[model samples]
Target: MKEESQTIRTKLAKIRFFSPEGFFVCAAIITVIFVAMEALGLRSSVAVLAGASPGAGAPATLGMACLYLLGYLAFVVLAPIFVMGSIFLLLVNLITGIFRRQQRHF
Candidate 1:
């Protein structure tokens, strides 16, 4: 159990923002955040973005809507890009590694 837990910790520690795995993790986090907010009924707050009064207070609702909009937009736009980026980076790394091994054999 201890060894397994330590290995999990080490794997988590290996993820950095600039790495492919880290990008996937970041995308996952962003998607989870968006899902949580949606589950909490924050999606209605987005009505403020369309000039509709979904709640009593315009300013407060608008602010919340704006914040939610930013997060939603980030998830919609950035998450897919991050996933693609991770795949692209993984492929590039694999190709380079293969070439390096071939060169060493020659």
Candidate 2:
């Protein structure tokens, strides 16, 4: 039992996700996305919907622009929520598996 506990601890340590290297890689990805958005001049759509630019409709409001921005933000927010939810589900499954296996041993 002691050996099994040590093995699990070692496996957790080796996952590397908690390391500084992994953190910086994720930060770099986020930075790149922001830079690309600025370069592409795509931020105007979000600004208009958020009412940063009310005169953006002076020529004629497309209405589609705000819809696109809403969709984009919804997708961006939902992606991480979905990913985290899946990770939580995976951890729950792992814990349940361990408990079931231990019960079988008894």
Candidate 3:
């Protein structure tokens, strides 16, 4: 029972997202997505009024445009910001952990 408990604890301790490196890797992935979206020129596809509307398929176009806009915003802005915040949180956790360990040692 004690060995099982120790193994469980060790597995939990090794979880990747608990560390700063994991957050940095996630941020890099989000940055790549943002760049890809910008390069694809899909960002401006959401401008509904900038071009003449289709005579019969306006609704379909509008729906697709909204979807594209949502995806663009998600990958271009929200995902990167969320990843950056995660990285910041990871850094804070690391710094506090270091300080707490030093305090315990002293």
Q: Which 10 successive residues of model 2 have the least lDDT summed? A: 18-27
RMSD list, candidates in order: 2.2, 11.7, 8.0
Q: Write the per-residue lDDT of candidate 3 for residues 11-91, one digit (tens) a residue.
A: 756758645555555566666765676676645655665775443247766775676666666676766676777778877
* CA lDDT, candidate 3, residue 54: 47
Q: Using TM-score as the measure, name the better of candidate 1 and candidate 3.
A: 1
Off by over 4 Å in 1: 1-10, 54-57
Output the better candidate (2/3) by lDDT. 3
Total clashing pairs for each candidate: 0, 0, 0
Cα lDDT tens digits, model 2, 75-102, are: 4664455455556656776899999999
Instruction: Name the 10 consecutive residues with the lowest summed lDDT in model 3.
Output: 48-57
* Top candidate (TM-score): 1
Off by over 4 Å in 3: 1-47, 53-57
Better-scoring candidate (TM-score), 1 or 2: 1
Q: How many angstroms is residue 79 displaced in model 2 relative to the true structure, after the best TM-score fit?
A: 1.2
